[model samples]
Target: MGHADTLLAMGGAFLAAAFFARLGNRIGLPTIPLFTLAGMLLGPHTPGFVLVEDAHDFEMLSALGLVLLLFYLGLEFHLDDLKTGGRRLALAGGSYLLLNVGAGFGFGLALDWGIREALVLAGVLGISSSAIVTKILIDLGRLGRPETRLILGVIVVEDVFLALYLAALQPVIGGAHGVAEVLFQVTKAFAFLLVLAATARYGTRLIGRLIHVRDDELLVISFLGAAVLVAGVSELLGVADAIGAFMVGLILAQTPSAARIRRLVHPLRDAFAAIFFFAFGLAIDPGDFAAVLVPVAVAATLTLLMNVAAGLIVARLYGYGPGPAADIAATLLARGEFALILAAMAATAGLDERLAPFIAGYVLVLAVLGPVAAGRAHLVVRRLTGGRTPDGPDDLAPVEAPERTTSA
Candidate 1:
């Protein structure tokens, strides 16, 4: 198709997705699934009503969207939490990741999907939607609740884990095989990450000094240029492009120019991120969704149960009572953009064809259900525990136990 035709197609897709987002907001549903569903409908694989004219162009744009999304996620990384949260945060967050990841892997094995696809599925099911969860916390006016604080700390831990996880996943996704080669690739990825981290830690002062452009236009261009350059280099080194972009974001997060960079890049991230989702749906055939729906339902149910249990364990470890514990669990239930990103990555890498649609359906289910469940967590907690909802000022407060709580 011609350039004008592609632009028109892109514009129409964005407008339709925007309308779906508005409609979701009106009905108190999450926007990610709405946007995904809209794309599926307009996609060539579905009724073929409205097609994106040039799939290759949209795919390139989608890749840029993924890089920007990862970069933004990196910028939001919370290093300060590691200091303030100390051991409690470590125990809670570590246990949460391991438990959920284990559950997902086991489920993948049950489906006989093999080790490679299982790993990818584990990641998709394990990572909570940081973007959606943050929005839920703010919208519900629960940002200051004690459990909410712990939840945010856990998300920071998840973010750190995901960055490293993506690094490790790169080699595996690149068709690395056998125990020795896999181990070697994993070691290389980790080594690269460690070297990058050390550089960021020691060279922060130098980076801070160099990013002192007074002109907003110059600063924005410089920041984006550096991010793209780093991402390109990372790909050249066999790491994923998103991983490279994330590292760049992490480096900038430490500099004084972090806020300025965030302010400028956020709008760009939002714009392209939507394209990423639309492009994902465009690649999926609607006919495949039904075949995956059963697994999606099963996986969603398992994640819901596991996340709640994990949240309660974390909350109780931090000395929170029943009510706040429920809040923490519900808040962690969201799974949206990151899951889609993983599915897209897997698709691009040519993993199991079934994995993509399964992920899309699974995310769609949870993205819609998570917010509603979180909003009603108090009632759920009360019903489950056979106790009235706490209404006092101290109800949402974070309390520490007299003794340190250890992970089970």
Candidate 2:
């Protein structure tokens, strides 16, 4: 197709996604899943007028969306919060990761898949979609809530674990025989992350001086260029671009320019994020999902229960009330990009073709349902327990809405 045609198609898709988001808002629902549903309907595999013919192009835009999304999340999150959370945060995050990974691994083994395939499934099912989580937090105005900090901290821990897991898995699965080669690859991954941490800790002032400008335009350009540059370098060094982008935001978060940087990047992030969700939907073929639907549904149900168990454990450790705990559980139920990436890697490495479609289906169902569940968690719990909130004796009192802070 011509450039004009491509641009028009992309533009139309964006508008449609926005419309769907608005529609979801009117219907008292989350927007991300709606956008993804819109993409599925307009996708090539579905019987409809496909707006995006070349998924590759939309994929690029989607990648940018992820970078911006993670970057924005980092701006909101802080290492200090995790530090202050201390042992509770560590225990909560660690236990949650262990439970999910264990569940996925056991599920794979139960299905009689080999160890390697089980490891792949474990990675897919274990990590929550940070993009989806961040959006829900912002949309619901829950970012500043106490439990939200724990949630973000746990997510950061999960991302770090995922990086290390992928690094080690790639070498092992690729048949790097020697202990030295595997150690070398794992060391490289940690070293890269260590450098990012150091920079975030010590180099913030330098970055501030270099990129902080009175001119908003120059500041935006400078910050954006740095984020993109770091992301590209991270990709070259065998880390995910979103991690690099997030590290940049972490460093900037320490500086005085964080609010401005956030303001400048907000529109870009939202715009590209919509495209990303749509592009994600575009790649999914409805036919491919059918064969794996039953197994995927069963696995998803198991994980959902596991997620609730994990969330409650973490919430109790951190001293959250039942209401907040339920919110954490519902939010953590989502699985997306990271899972999709692992599934794709499994396919690329020929570890398992069946893994990808099952993952696609599973993630689709949960990602859509998770946000809705989170938004209505209080109501669900109330209804389940005979129309009373879960806060012990106070359950009889009318459940008040959570206080939404002005800060994103």
Candidate 3:
């Protein structure tokens, strides 16, 4: 397409996203799914306006969206919060991965798609979309709630797991059989994470000085540069770009300019994030979903059950009631970008033909369902508990526990 046509298509996409999201808001629906639906309706995959002939046209913008989404999430997540729930976060995150990933692997094997296909499915169904979850929390106005901390913490944990998981899976999928090669990949990934963690823990002041500036415009440029640069470096190192951006945000969050950076980045994050989800929808061919409907249904059902069970377990670990448990489950139920990435990897590796469509359908189902479920979490819990809701404040407030003694 010509430059003018590209501009026009982008403009159409943005407007369509805004219109659908507005309509969703009127009906009390979350914007993430609506934005995706907008892309699907207008994309080349479907019979419609065809905003962009290829989703890859928006690939870089979509990547920026993902980076900004995670970056903002990290900015909101203070270092103090991480320190407070370190151990619980590890346990909760580990439990979530074990349940979802283990079940997903077993499900894939049951499909008889092959062991490598099962590995892809494990990651696809196991990891939640951090971008979608971040958007949902903001849109639902639940960012300040106590449960929100756990949700974000769990996502961070998941991202870390993803780094290690991808390293190990890449060799298997690529048909690399050497034990030394696999160990090297794993060690490289682990070392990268360690370096970033150390930086976040101790290099905040240096980073702060580097990015600090009198003008908001300059500061914005500085931080954006840092995020994108680090994301690029991460991708080169076989780590996910989103994690690098997130780590940058986490480190900057400790600086005095954290609030200003957050303020400046909010609008950018929202706009780019819309493009991210829209591009995701644009890539999906709804025609493929028909063949994988049964598998999608089964996978979706399994995901929902596993997520709820994991959420309840985490809630109990943290001494939260059913209400919080419901919230956690519903919020974490969405599988998205990571699933798509895995499907693409599988396709590239000549794995099972059915895997891509299954994942696409599964992500579509949960992306829409997850946000809806989160919105109705309170009502769902109330109904299940016979309409006896938890007492005042406890529903949204952090319960006073020994583990939560540190102040936010």
Candidate 4:
């Protein structure tokens, strides 16, 4: 095919994905699963329209997409939100982490997984999809709500844990020589982070000054360049590049140029994220999934139950009424991009390919159901709270209309 034809193929794939995604949302289901399914339909395993055989590059591009995702997330975050959300951020986030990780780890051990695999799965379970949750909160215009704010605060906590986990994983997965060497590695890793932190604080300003007078094009390349530089530094330090990318995000997070940077980068993020989902779907062998339906269903069901329980228990402990607690819990039940990323990592690290499809199938089911569960949960809450509004139990009367959108 000619260059234009190849570009057309890429364009057509995304258009189909977007069309199905919107179609899914119109019918009241969240579009997360449909996007993946859309990718699958356009991939090699389908009857026709396979467009992603050149998938090796998508991995890095997808990683870039996630880097932007986290960057945007940090743009809206602060260490201070932990203080503002009351004790709920720490309490609820902490409780949710402990219960979910502990339970997931225990289950992995029971299934005879290695320590590394168990720990990895535990970490994955502990971390929620901040993207999906944040998307829902924004879609609903509930970003300023107490529950929403608390969720973001907890998500920051989760990101901290993710950084630590991803960093510590190298040695835990046997990439180090000894305790002293591991200690040295950890030190080097953190020392590298310090340099990046310094760049965040200092480099951005100089670069901002340099590009201050230019058009937004410079902003686009400069921001992506910073992320790549930090990510390269992380690789040299023998650590996960994600930590470095995340640190870059933290630094650019609250800058005067942050909004401008986000506006410049979001198109690329969305485009590459579509390819990310497509590559993810390519990794799934549906035949493999169908053959082991029983075990897969069991694992998926367990995942759903555990996630919902974790969210609810934390909400209740933080003093939310049962209805709001349940609503928050239900909203958090789906695992999206992060889960796929982790599964890909696990496969590379030699932890059971079967686990990926099982988890993927679960994600597909929950992505469709989670929003309905959350929406209906609001109705249930209104009834229980006796016509109280979601944002404030006494501020406004109950709204019977579809007054919210929770697409992620």
Off by over 4 Å in 2: 109-117, 130-180, 318-325, 336-351, 375-408
Highest-scoring model, TM-score = 1
- Per-residue lDDT tens digits of candidate 3, residues 283-314? 76778778889988999999999999999898
Q: What ranges in model 3 sit over 4 Å off?
A: 78-80, 114-116, 129-156, 159-177, 320-323, 336-356, 375-408
User: Per-residue CA lDDT of candidate 4, range 270-340, in tens?
Assistant: 67666667667766667677855765466556666776677677666555566557656766765676666
Query: Which tens-of-lDDT digit does each residue in 1-408 have in candidate 1?
Result: 787888788898789878988998898887778878877888777665766633566877888888898888777664565777778887898888987888988898888877778888888888888888888887798866666778887887788888888888878887877879988988877777777787577887898888768899999888888888888888877778888888888888899998888888988888888888888877777799888888999999999889888977897787666787788888888898878878877877788899988998898888988899899989987887786865335544453211111000
Candidate 3 achieves a global lDDT of 0.78
lDDT agreement with native, every candidate: 0.80, 0.75, 0.78, 0.65
Q: Identify the leading candidate in terms of lDDT.
A: 1
lDDT of 4: 0.65
Model 1: residues with Cα > 4 Å off, grouped in runs: 385-387, 390-408
* True-vs-predicted CA distance for residue 73, candidate 4, Å: 3.2
Give RMSD to native, each candidate: 4.2, 4.4, 4.3, 4.8
lDDT of 2 by residue, 233-299 (tens): 8766656667778788878888889889888898888888778778767766778777787889888
lDDT of 2 at 242: 72
Model 3 TM-score, 2 decimals: 0.83
lDDT of 3 at 30: 56
TM-score of every model? 0.93, 0.83, 0.83, 0.83
